[model samples]
Target: MSKRGKVWLGVAGLVINDEGEWLVVKKSYSGLKGKWSLPAGFVDEGETIDEAVIREIKEETGIDCQVKGLIGFRTGIIRDEISDNMAIFLATPRINQPFVKSERELLACEWRTPKSLVTDHLTSAMLKEMASSTPHETQFCVNETVDPGDIFGYTSYKLFF
Candidate 1:
């Protein structure tokens, strides 16, 4: 890896409904506009990955959800310089409500069947795989909610298992 490379942490959520449909969105901010994908964004400083995933899902889809566990993650080098790593989380909605897409951040928001998402050409490979598989099948990791004061001097620390 080059010394000039930087790593960016991101989060995505697989928000599943009782009907087994997954929530997804189309980005409106960049060239990726019109492409369907899981609601995802860069993790903000001072925020945990699970918190980031929940926030992203709410901001993009307008549906509140709680993180159940982490299903998986993906890491790759962008242009051989920037390192991109994303954590995929399994979550469920907290209330029965409709999803309102953010006009500035999303082109569309809708529920998609696992098969539909998996077959869609516009969906990314990781998103497709996550949609097609369940958390149990993927061997999910859960936040152990360890105390930061006990483990480290940092104000905030999260350990997953």
Candidate 2:
């Protein structure tokens, strides 16, 4: 198969509440429309992955979050797109607040347990890795580096890291 001539680096956050549920979103486009997955999107130039995670969570779920640690990264090759890389980080909300869904872009928002989400056919590899790992005692065996893409209206965000 041939690549789609595009490069992309996406950042996603695994924000769990006191109840131990991860925040997920229904994306509106970019091959993920109508799929329930972790809240994430393309990172921008001059934007750190941490900031992207925080902003993406807020924008998608309307809940403020802070990155706890970098869990790890996962790489995948689409059938016709450039090979993809997604960095998944651990996060928590600043305040114990519930989220309200956005009126645009996202179709819905909900908190789900890892066991239920892991086997989903619609689940992306990024989320599956996070769900498969033990939250407190995970091991990092490798390092991954990736480049970012240019998606219009996708701007860098400032957040508490």
Candidate 3:
């Protein structure tokens, strides 16, 4: 029998500003190193995936955002035994503020036109695909927040449909 490792949960956002520009960030490490991709990161303990994505965007770009809906998910075996599942969300900035890039986790944070990202060789295929789809064009899963304290006596609960 094959021993399996724990599955890691991750989140990313297809954040588009009111002007219709997509948010892209360049990380300092991982497969995304030096590549402009959607703002993404691993989910920390005690936080929901939606919260994680919102935090990631804030940390990486200094922009506050709200998740519009669950857009999609990707799941795959990352290594011999470990696996990864990432949820993608369609989001929009809540405030019209300039982005301040994180010097610690990112090399660059910029807003680019979807067409520009699609044509930029520096943009990864995954990012290009994300940028190609707009919030209005893509279908999103319904996201509903529930109070777990009332149901399971937990802190938080979220339902994605």
- TM-scores, one per candidate: 0.77, 0.72, 0.78
- How far residue 124's Cα lies from its native spot in candidate 2, in Å, is 3.7
Candidate 2: pairs in clash: none
Off by over 4 Å in 3: 1-5, 133-161
Superposed on all Cα atoms, the candidates' RMSDs to the truth, in angstroms, are 10.3, 8.1, 10.7
Q: List lDDT for all candidates, in order.
A: 0.74, 0.69, 0.75
Ranking by lDDT: 3, 1, 2
Kindly list the per-residue Cα lDDT of model 2 for residues 1-161, writing each as its tens digit: 13324666888888889889888887877666666678887787788888888888888889998898987665655444455667878899899786777778787788888887888766654465557666556455542322112332223311111
Instruction: Go through the candidates in order and give the clash count of each.
Output: 0, 0, 0
The TM-score ranking, best first, is 3, 1, 2
Model 1 lDDT at residue 107: 84
Error of 2 at 22 (Å): 0.8
Weakest ten-residue segment in model 3 by summed lDDT: 147-156
